[model samples]
Target: MIYINFNGSLHFKTDAIFTSQNRFAFGDGFIESFRVFNDKITFETLHENRIKASCEVLFLELEKFNLEEEVSKVLIANKLKNARVRIHFFRVGNGRYLPETNQCNFLVEAEDDNVQAFHLHTIETISLSKQYFKASHSLGNIKSSSALLFVLAAKEANKNTWNDAILLNENKAICEATSSNVFIRKSDGLLLTPPLNSGCVAGVMRQKVLQLLQQNSYQIYEQNFTVSELENAAEIFLTNATKGIQSVVKFNNKKLENNIAIELVSLLNKEIGL
Candidate 1:
């Protein structure tokens, strides 16, 4: 096999890395991620909507940004079909943390893939401040650049032999993982997860599962639960756009009962016609 690298920019295509000069970039943009499977995209609208909302939440005032169209164009330019995709919008820093009013950039990357599962580890973490209980707070529940805090926690999970970390709120209630929403199966048939009021990212998959639970009249709870509840949970599972639904085999050095998780997977699979 052979590969070649070239300088200078061209039009938007697989061969073109940028649309303008090196110092050229816009001041405001949004990013999105999607999973392509069997030549189809699941929950495509959800991913697009999240990108739009993320930009709006970050207060990035831009004249126009089209994420879905850009993604489609990039896929075609690269002669690609299905995989995981990420799109990030960039703008010039306003000489500070904020962005300037003019110029912007769009960054997109995708790859065909295959994945089995993710490993999870228990980690130490500090919850958010009481003032951040509301989503209207600057970084609360926005799914933005605030992942640094989660990164620190994920280090603890890795140090202690885990893939990621779970964070709690100021009240010591189980919130969510570093990059995903969490669920715990109870003795009852209800599926349990933290509510948006708990200061966690409102994940799209989480939304889908919740909708399924509600539609079938399955007992479900969206209230605060403690770490102890997580440990003693009859079943523990995790979900994200990338990972889908994963059963937690072990947590805090204890093995979880994956029976409920397996059943829930079957239930969800049946519901989604997967």
Candidate 2:
């Protein structure tokens, strides 16, 4: 009895809600995904704000709809407790490059998930992506449906037998990983990550982790750096809403430590009351 919420209504998962003129034609939308643990949507406020901000950027009007309530409906209909929820928001109308209306339609879906709390994972190896570079533009910060850059980068990483691929901006500065925000920890206990201007997605988990680091009196900086700069880093980790923290063990041939990441996981789970 899989169910989905489409434009404020619940329907079977197989219900058709999009036309070729909409989603498939222009990829004219954005999406947000987050975890639900113990019947609670983690960071619900942050996710709501990000979705609204992204809709504003894309000119998709959400009006007065309640996001959390809608997601709850889908979760309840599907009888899910711990789950991975996704919301797809797209403009509805008739037009080419220009949309006929700014009104937005959204679809909410949830799937059962086994992960109940944030856990630290290890990546054996990672490499820089050579085929594509993330565009250094404001639009790059939005989680738009057009994600070919990341899709190709992930494919390249798998083909090269690397755990993941690091994406660089047009300026040749480290942007982020295929699906997570990048963080580098120096031997001196300093933390560094690419600024939003570096063309990295403004990840929700990245925001929360930064806040936690600051509260714990950790020195952190949102700055752009090149791969050469990483040689001096003592440790590196990636963060995203789904995975929380993933420590990278090797970059090229240099082995990195995960002491800080391991500590952060415990702090993160505690902060979330998990």
lDDT of 2 by residue, 103-211 (tens): 8888899999978998899999999998989989999898888888889999999999999999999899999999999999988888999999998998999999899
Could you tell me the lDDT of residue 220 within candidate 2? 91
lDDT of 1 by residue, 112-207 (tens): 665322223332222222222223233555665434566677666667567556777766788887777888887665568998878877677788
C-alpha lDDT values of all predictions: 0.60, 0.89
Task: Determine the C-alpha RMSD for candidate 2 after optimal superposition of all C-alphas.
Answer: 1.2
Lowest-scoring 10 consecutive residues by lDDT in candidate 2? 16-25
Q: Using TM-score as the measure, which candidate wins?
A: 2
How well does model 2 score by local distance difference test? 0.89
Query: Which run of 10 residues does model 1 get worst, by summed lDDT?
Result: 1-10
